[model samples]
Target: MNFEVVLTCAVTGAGDTTGRSKHVPVTPEEIARDAVEAARAGASVVHLHVRDPQTGKGSRDPALFRETVDRVRQSGVDVVINLTAGMGGDWTPAKDDWAMPGPGTDMIGPDERLAHVRDCLPEICSLDCGTLNFGNDDTIYISTPPILRRMAALVREWGVKPELEVFDLGHIRFAKAMLAEGLLADPPMFQLCLGIPWGADQTVETMAAMKAQLPPGASWAGFGISRMQMPMAAAAVALGGNVRVGLEDNLFLGRGVLATNAQLVEQAREIIERMGARVLSPQEARNRLHLRGADA
Candidate 1:
């Protein structure tokens, strides 16, 4: 097993889980504070997503991102910031017309989806590789090939590392194709997202298959939602990959337990250590992932 691992804390996602659990951060200040806490608890990276303060729903507002990043940076913490460019892509088809997008659809162009990244200029931004059947019912997460290519190019131009997020085998294939086309920079970075309904299932076989599909000399991490979070962290490290954990993917530490982002990071750190592995510091993680520092 590889002895070095990097743990990323997904502070808050664009999911509707805020109502499901009160522990989910809602406002920009809360999210930033939670990120700082996670960093203090041993997360080298903080994966961020802003929410609409009023409704606790996910948003792509640049102002929200700016505030959150500023707060985290000013806290004197050394965590690498990884902002999400995965919003503004949810599409729920209309009941009247199966073809037309219905209410609650947050569809936008690739450029629009990445506008926050351009504005915030975080060290890392996510580039969801392919579209998938997201959520229950008619909601479809749309990330077309052309859109992905455009986003990848834009990320490269901005000099920000794109964390290629793959949810299935097809997404991994597309990620390889992008790398082959020279869209991704050297030491391509990836995030294998598992356990969401309609996407890749959470299993050792699935994780191994996805890891095997990465391009040569890639730096990657894998995350599993809910109860699989810590288990996948071990699995990922065992497979020569990094790990991610947080309240975004899971809210519970165990049965009948509610976990904060800091608790999740602490647990991941413990697991990494017990496996005879050392967790990467923020600086080391930045170097491994090719992320630009604050001065950059």
Candidate 2:
């Protein structure tokens, strides 16, 4: 079991959680505030995804990313910033025409997708290791092998660590291929995402299976969504991995109770501490994960 954990708080995901809970930050100011508060509450890293303030929908705007990241940096907070490079890959085909893009389709080239990552230059960014059926809907997240290779190369050039987000066993296999091809950096960082629909299930068995497949000299974390968030956090720590928790993956602190980013971080920190493990600080996490450091 891991005695020290790297706790990440995904303050605001690009999901439809804003309507369910007013605590989901939409504007840049709110996002920055929540991220800083989560850091103060014991989050070593803050994962961010910018949203369209006017519509409360996920956006790929570079300006929004810049302002939000600037606010967080200016707050004098010491936390690793992790931006979501998983956007701009949604592909929902039109009902009548399989070849035509649908209303929810927002597909773009790898460069266009990483524009915000280029602008913000976060210390780390997520790289979804494979495509998924995302939800029960007709939407499919299109992260093909070629696309992922290009993205991995781009982030490596920028000296930004790509958090290899593997959602299933196949994703893990392909990520390993990337490693073999010298596309990824040494001491790879991974996030075993669980409980998302049509991907890996949320269970200790599933996390263990995924964790066992990680490459040597790898730093990894695991998280589940909804009600399984805390359980998965505990499971990750027990499995000698780190933990992640926040409104991105879960919206409730308890039944019928909405949660803020800070509350979620506190809850996860409490769980780690109660299990006789301590959450790492930003600098500690950076060194453990072999990141470019806080200044980077």
Q: Which model scores highest in TM-score?
A: 2
Over the full model, what C-alpha lDDT does candidate 1 score relative to the true structure?
Answer: 0.91
Model 2: how far is 24 from its true place, Å?
Answer: 0.6
Once fitted onto the true fold, the runs of candidate 2 whose alpha carbons sit more than 4 angstroms away are 294-296
Q: Candidate 1's residue-wise lDDT over 87-142, tens digit each? A: 98889989999899899899899999998899989889999888888877888899
Give the poorly placed runs of model 1, Cα more than 4 Å off.
Answer: 294-296
Q: What's the distance in Å from true for residue 194, model 2? A: 0.4
Quote the lDDT for 268 in model 1. Answer: 94
**What's the count of clashing pairs in each model shown?**
0, 0
TM values, all candidates: 0.98, 0.98
Pairs in steric clash, model 2: none
TM-score of structure candidate 1:
0.98
lDDT of 1 at 176: 88
